[model samples]
Every structure is written in structure tokens, then in C-alpha cells.
Target: LRETRSYTWGLVIPDLTNFGFASIARSLEAHCREAGIQLLIACSEDDPALEQRVVDNLISRQVDGLIVASSGHSDDIYARIHDRLPVVQLDRHIGESRLPMVISDACKATAELVRDMASECGAEIYYFGGLLDLSPSRHRLAGYELGLHRAGLEADPARVRHRDYQPSSGYQLMAELVAELGAPPRGLFTASFTLLEGV
Candidate 1:
């Protein structure tokens, strides 16, 4: 009564160059290949419009499912796609939608790590983060604050920077901190590997 399955899955990521995303795509492709499924990977380059076009293109090709690390611009497209196909949000998500998500628990881990940094340094700790529009960033920030609280320290509002998840943003934030203090930070926590690479 129905057409044969395409045996193909689409994966859309914000940045294919990112190591984490690349590894995911690589692992998934391997698995899909072993299962006799073709994996179609697309890079959004962190643009919502580009993401839309790729998703549409994948759908046109009749992909069996999709794994998206969205740009956090909106939920309309993913939600619409989910109606007819299985859409799984990976790494990042727009919000809590009906669709399922596979995300890292950056919150608890961040908090613990920050606490360790505070305890070891016994001084003011600075946080460098990425855009709060995504869930991972928000969770990491909360975790940083929680870590400081656990260490009997307070988060210095002035020392926290929430910029985009780019190497340039990381560099800029580091420069700003150094300029303001006229010295490098003693206790520093960089969230997001891209930001870490930047700083």
C-alpha cells in the first residue's frame, strides 16, 4: 500500500567544520552505511535560511529521517518537518517541542568543573561563553554560577561574557578582559570548544 523506503537519512548541522559535529556525522555515516542506509549530510553554516533550503532539499529527496543541529532561529521548520518525518534535534534545539532531542548535559558537568576551578584557584574566576539563544550555552552559564555557589564564591557579573560561538568572539572577549584588568585572568573557564579554541 505504500512506497518503498528510501533507506536514506539526512543530517543538518550548524557547522560541519566543528570537530564535535564532524565526529557525529562521521559516526552516523558509518552506522548508516553498515545498515545499508545512505547518509546525506548538509551544513547550515549557522544560517536559518540555508538550513531551511537544505531541509527542504532533503525532504524532496524523501529521506527516511533527519538529525538537525539547528541555528536556534525558529521552530517552525523542524516542527513542520516532524509532522511527516522523524526529526531528531541533536546538539542544539530551539525549545522544548514535541520532537525528541539528543543533547549533552552541560549544566551539571559545567557546575562541577567550575567548582573545581574555584577551589583550586581560590580567586575570582571568569566565564567565557557563547550565545544564550541555544540551550547548551544557557545550561553552561547556569552551571558556572552553580559551581561558584558550591565553591562558596559568587559569580562576578562583570567577568562573564556571552558572545556568539565563534573563535573571533572568543578572542575579542579575551582581549576585552585583559584590557580591562591589564592582565590575563587567573581562573578562566571557557565554554564551547570553539570559544576555547578562540581564546
Candidate 2:
């Protein structure tokens, strides 16, 4: 939008091997290049402390802006950078911070997925993902129930699983659901990309 070319940007991510994160970073790199900007990509290995350190490093390098994709270190990182540069939060949020955000509509996606599962397979819907401590987890669960209700089906509390958005957590919950329900729900919607790996 700034009709400028040849800017510099810092791309901070939790991990590089994560396909989703890498794809996002590459997309940003491509966009920057196409717009005549240069991007420096960095990874923090999902460690908040490392992310904070990376933030300082990037700032010192004098990058024009930052793209933080759901970091464990977002709160502190953004707090340090917000006053001086543009920081776009993707797939996460820090309350009341004046940072711009670009994120998928997770809640809406969850609701629609559940509703579709209910229709396609006549299956009981389960909402699974994220730590209970996270707002997105809570919101996605709410969306699941709301979607079920909209589809004229009430969510069976027994069918819903809450996990820590990890593959092991997802495996455990899937096992638990099978144990309790005596089978899979015919369709499962996972809010966590990691969980999807297990599913």
C-alpha cells in the first residue's frame, strides 16, 4: 500500500520445519520480494525466551516490520517492539496491544466443519484442540456446540475432547473418545494442526 519498494522485513516464527509456518514465511518472502523488499527469516523453536531474544536481534538489524506467527513469546516480544515498528500477529493475539493481526477465522471454520461432519456422515461432532488455557480453544469449542445446535443437533458433552494442541494429546483424546463412545465419531474436527497429525 505504501507504493514503496526495497524495504526490509523480519519474519519470526516458532519453527521452520513446521510446514504451516514455513509456508507462511515463504509466502511473506515472496510477497516482499515481489514488492521489492528483502526479508530476513528467523526461527525460535517454540521457545518464548528464544523468541524474545530473536525479537531483539531483529530490531537491532533494523528490519522495517515483523510478522509473528503465534509465538509463545508474542506478549513480551510485541510489548518490546510495538512502539517502534509494525508487528502483525498471525494466529494469536495479545489483549489491548496496538498490534495489527492477520489470522484465519478459526471459530467460524470450526463451526462449519462440525456442521458439515454432522451432515456428511451423520456423525457426532467433537471439538478438539489447544490448551484449555488458550482463548482459541475455548472459542472453538463454543463454536462446535453452536454449530451443532444450528444443525439441529446438540453436542454430546461426552463426545467433545479438549487437548493441549499436541499430537500426543490428540492421540490420547482419540483413544479416550473410542473408549467412551465405543468407536470413532465417524468424523472429527481438530483445531490443532499438531493434533491433526495424530488424527
User: Highest lDDT among the candidates is held by which one?
Assistant: 1
- Pick by TM-score: which candidate is best? 1
Candidate 2: Cα lDDT at 110: 76
The alpha-carbon lDDT assigned to residue 7 of candidate 1 equals 94
User: Positional deviation of 22 in candidate 1, in angstroms?
Assistant: 1.5
| lDDT, candidates in the order shown | 0.87, 0.74
Sliding window of 10 residues with minimal summed lDDT for model 1: 72-81
Q: What's the residue-level lDDT of 101 in candidate 1?
A: 89
Q: Looking at candidate 2, what is the lDDT of residue 93?
A: 64
TM-score each candidate: 0.93, 0.80
Once model 2 is optimally superposed onto the true structure by TM-score, how far is the C-alpha of residue 189 displaced, in angstroms? 0.8
Model 1: lDDT of residue 53: 95
Least lDDT summed over 10 consecutive residues: which range in candidate 2? 70-79
For candidate 2, write residues 67-178 as lDDT tens digits.
8765452366576677777888876665544678787766787778778778875546676766654456666887788778778887887767775655787788888888
